[model samples]
Target: MNLAELSQLDGPSSELLYNFGLQPVSNRFLSGNCQNSAPTFSLELRINRDSGLIHLGKAFPVDELKPRYSWLTCFEPEDHLDAMVKTIINLPGVDKDSVFGAYSFKDDSTLQRLDYLGYTKQWRIDPEQDLGISDPCANVETYQAVFTPTVAQQICQNHGAADVIIVRHVVEHANNLSGFLESIRALIKPNGYIVWELPDCERALEVGDCTTVWEEHVFYFTTFTFKLLLESAGFSIVHYESVPYPLENSIVAIVQEGKGQNNPNFSDSRIVQEEIDRAYRFVDTIKFRRHAIRNKLENFRENVGRIALFGAGHLSVAFLSTLGLCDLIDFVVDDNPNKKGTRMPVGNLAIKGSEALYSEKVRLCLLGINPRNQSKVIAKHSLFEEQGGQFASIFPGSEVYLEHIS
Candidate 1:
């Protein structure tokens, strides 16, 4: 569909910036021999003029779209979590005795770090177990579950209101942002604090990083938009930081309820124009890059023996499918054992272990993993390079990029 069609589809209050066509649900890793095609939906990014929120044009069903997460913070660098825990604990009225609660298993690493730093009283909300959920399709298994105000009330009733709620990387997946925030507020005590982390999209938008746009994340938040969103949701940002990492940087925010004020800057004409301008640039940059990358891969396929993409994360899925590079890739390599024998969504390419690089004789492997961890992966699979296999970045501007491809 064209721009005109999308604008009409989402209403005039929203401006359509980019359309990613039909993309398969990113995390639906299939069994290796599954012959059925993975389900897909139209992925489009648009900005709401009224709220200044950048979001998806269409909202997919929560149950079908909720991810079976393979991501764990323990596998990542500890510096970010170290800084985050230090920031929250240093806040007044927060101590080891203060209750800490999280929405899912994803927050276990952060809670463990908090415990290490003396905040030992931590509680995790298991929807099925704690909330008495019996249905298999309740969509509570993942962090993507939207905590309504009622759900929050029940949580507070079952296990007294938390002194601090740690919601890491879950807010962006929220289809109902306001409800999600209000629910979290309900779960926290009046004097409690909320510490949350999510991908900072400002850098990605400026550089037009296609990896930042995912089917799972309904909203793409810049620092400005994030603060505005929190304030609008009745929270005041007490502390904020952009934790630097590869691909997308994480936004860590410590906030308190009932302390928000309507910032005049939110409605500034200049700010609105600036957001629109960035959206335009993002569209142009992505369009140009997609064309260039597609051309490069077409030529590379003729010369290169076989191509495999490293990393089966959502970013890798977006990079391949959004840019239509799936057909060019022979298979995807991921270290996660759970994904090794599975299949990627759109392309249905077999997800293989790192050993596939040597066994399959993959001549060229594009790195779709985080740039920070790329060196470690390459070192672990050093034998692949020793056998004349080459590694290159799927996208340009990263530290580990192919001069020819970029």
Candidate 2:
């Protein structure tokens, strides 16, 4: 998995890699039939030269939408993250004082979550600088505003290897997952463990979630492919299970270094075709579904004016392009401090904090995200609902009220 380790592979090892169906991303490419009426978007899903991951194709115009921070902002959920943390905390034999590196917390949320969970305390972060015995160990449980790879590496190399490393939703953004995994292994003690939470690739198909395929995402994953990635990095799977629904379709795999095992059927050609077929089926129908949603929104617009969108996440962009409802939205409402005041990538509507809703006097707010949060959202903004505000969900099949007070 490490660059150095890759160079150490002998001819037979390399040949076995190919025979075992571990092909380099060099063969990864995109090929898909466009729906005659599919709205053009900068994002498209392509095969990763294997069955487990899907790569985003070239940018194309979709209802005047373009890409923004494909790799920067991954837009995941808070509760789901909390659950991942709970999973790690529940893992047996985790050393409390053992070094805990978040690896890629992306923001202070993970650090904050760990603290909130009564795990670790505040630790000042110094970038790429050595920390003495008294200094914070760059642990995921330590709170810090910003963490760069250099800072992370310093922590990885500092003192000794990490006892428990946690990486969440970061693999898809990685250009070289193999190298990253190897690098992580070197940072951990032989007895250390890693917990990785990734969005389930096949779950996207099962739930009819097309937004999962995008340029920012370098790959999608299923257990079969992920096992390949872990084993290739010389890690052994200790525990792996998908998080429950009403939550994102994700897996938290607890791993350690040892002989890696992969499913024999995953490498089969027929199996590969089946996986590709499932992916293509989703992509093919997405365009029509997007268009249909747009029409429905327009229909509702006939009755409701000055509508608002409930979430300013990636789904906001997906909704705008699919519904061409950017001009129709008043502002995108969200609780994330970072998102407020930013403009929706394509919608160009201002990202307003949830508090912004209290003063809007709006009648209807189209739920741009999964309707799952409808009740909580409405309760959180009681004034909005009390002022005769209502919500409509944007799920694929129909525009149902994921939650309605009436």
Candidate 3:
């Protein structure tokens, strides 16, 4: 059947499964190879209800299952499917012998042809593009390489004299985390250390930040789970700290090579479980707050004449999706030339440049950026304010009105 037919058939069931924490499989075009002569195939992703065990059909194309260039490969690709399955089997609520089925597409089939998967398009950063800040570690050896655990091992091997290899933002969405950790262990000399920096899911849970669970970020690491994971990977944690960053939580883990033994005494599974429990409680408390916020936005939409959303980052997409603000806003405005004219992620809203601010019909601009960029955003649009433009800020759980500058 065509994509429309398949979507219609699967949509309700998919929603039902997803709401229950089970990931229902869907047929999607392979990344980059969508235009290939062979017909695109469907993948059956069976997620265990309790353990998050993800399994796939054996016939799934290797490239499509684990696109080397795609972030999903690093996050939870088929290569890590076995590990996910193992984890799921160890969970409380799983039927070990359940059989799953797979489906295929043929040239003669009535299904509508889909273009190759757009995985590469998601993070295709231009090499020459500047992000307004000089490289902080410009003097440090610039390593032009892929971000993988094996790559981390190689870095340690190449820099033999280095005592510690600090990896910032490298282990966020790792699929084969066990393998990656093993590689890191292999590279470390006796007494050598490895530092991993990642997002703290505990903080995100405390703040009721649903945006933390996006497609790009598949795993949420609580301190306990993180510690357990590290120990399992053969690293003894020297230090662990949680930092406060509004947009993204931070965790710094210092690990050192040990006496070739996995220490079960350091396992913090109970601590991780407690943090998860706290997260669930926090989520429950925010339900009413979220409802109130939605009501307020709906009221504003009914009263406001012309509204435009400013910012096209992930936050904007999450706001639009979570708050159901698509019909309320006219268009999205962004400073990034790359995102301009492209559809916003998840929300699929058409993105426009800052020039959209000049439109006389737009009475208000809703800022969807993080607080750090608030002042710069206001300053950049200062000229527009002189002509009676209004501004507002939309954060995760709150919205505030700003005065129009002369």
Candidate 4:
């Protein structure tokens, strides 16, 4: 994003430019605040040109010890974290007070739920040591500061401060994982656990999905590469599990702060190379896929007229931008009531409630989201199916053009 555009953000601070470093694919826009009021400030996305990766410019981790309205806004990609935490706490001999949460601002609700799940006294670690001055845009006094990233500085600042730090959905945005992990090692209890969660690159390619590739995500991980990287930083993988099947495929990796003889399977060169091959292949075919999706939309327009999108999450933004598919859309439709009247993150479409889709007689609602949950989404929003709405498919084992509701 340019200086002029950066000047307009509701919350622009030195933290953004200091950590994000200014190159981007598009201008900033208001995205979801973890899909709710979240008291957590909403941050924007920026891309690194030299390396194709997504970076969440702002990093202000907040601990929601106090319950507030948490007004519903948009669905955060941080969904399913509640379940993940529940499972983590179930581990035997867990230290309640030592359970610290790091690397997020909007995940307070999920972290707060950990108390009920048997985790007590969770501390929200802010990686931004400096809050820097606010952007001169100066409109809303409440939303004027941008929190920047200083992983090493902040981690050192909190040296030996955490026994168990839970980092969820935050690592992929790191440009320097080794440095970040080293800082984290300094803060962690000598043998404390650092549970990490992120979307899987291998799965993204296997399914022909490229929407996960965005300006905000700089590094993608395979279980093995991540394990090797962590081990190199004097950390040991205690447990690792690849989520079998889900809308956005991901993995849960639990690591300890010391290096040891652990995880023999981390040396699989074959699977490691396979993951690399898949990522390269996805890059190779992205333009073609975008063209193919555009053609599919055009054919749909020829017969059905301008349509809308059913989601407004990060994946949706990435897909629309990557394929130049935003203009082809009339508007966006979402199940989240809080998102109504909001604009699409990367385009001009107004987000409307489910009722609006039917009122407009939307011929099709591009399920511009992860396809794993397509059946469940359609089933819940039966009006779309009963009213003869359709969706376009661009993933593996799926037909081209519009696919009817089955």
Per-residue accuracy of model 3 over 87-168 as CA lDDT, tens digit each: 3233232232221110111110111111121111111111123112133322101122222455544444443423333344
Which residue pairs in candidate 3 collide? 1-111, 30-117, 34-116, 74-175
Q: How accurate is candidate 3 locally (lDDT)?
A: 0.45
Q: Compared with the true structure, what per-residue lDDT tens digits does model 1 show for residues 1-406?
A: 2222212226677878888888888768888888987789888888867545588998776767755553422233456887787788889998778999997655888899888877888788876656665454344324335357887888888888999998887778776666677778888999899988888888788888888887777888877778767666656779988887666788888988754454424557677677778877888988987788877777777886888999988779888887788888999998788888889986888999988888888988899887877888889888888888888886557765753652
Superposed Cα RMSD, model 4: 9.7
Give per-residue lDDT, candidate 3, residue 329. Answer: 74
lDDT-wise, the better of 2 and 3 is 2
Per lDDT, the best of the predicted structures is 1
Off by over 4 Å in 1: 1-12, 50-52, 67-78, 134-146, 259-264
| Global local distance difference test of model 1 | 0.76
How many clashes show up per model? 0, 3, 4, 14
Residue 88 displacement in candidate 4 (angstroms): 4.6
RMSD of candidate 2 to the truth, in angstroms, is 10.2
- Ranked by TM-score, the better of candidates 2 and 4 is 4
Worst 10 residues of 4 by lDDT: 136-145
lDDT of 4 by residue, 1-406 (tens): 3212222222232122112122223223344433422132333433222122223454332222111224523233555666677666765456665556554554566667777766665666443332332323211111112322354345536543566676666666543444455555555666677887777666665556756555545455666555555654556667787775554556788887565543334345566456555545665566567777678777877886668887766567667766677778888777666666666546556778878777888887777656666666677778776777776544455442243322
Better of 2 and 3 by TM-score: 2
Best by TM-score: 1
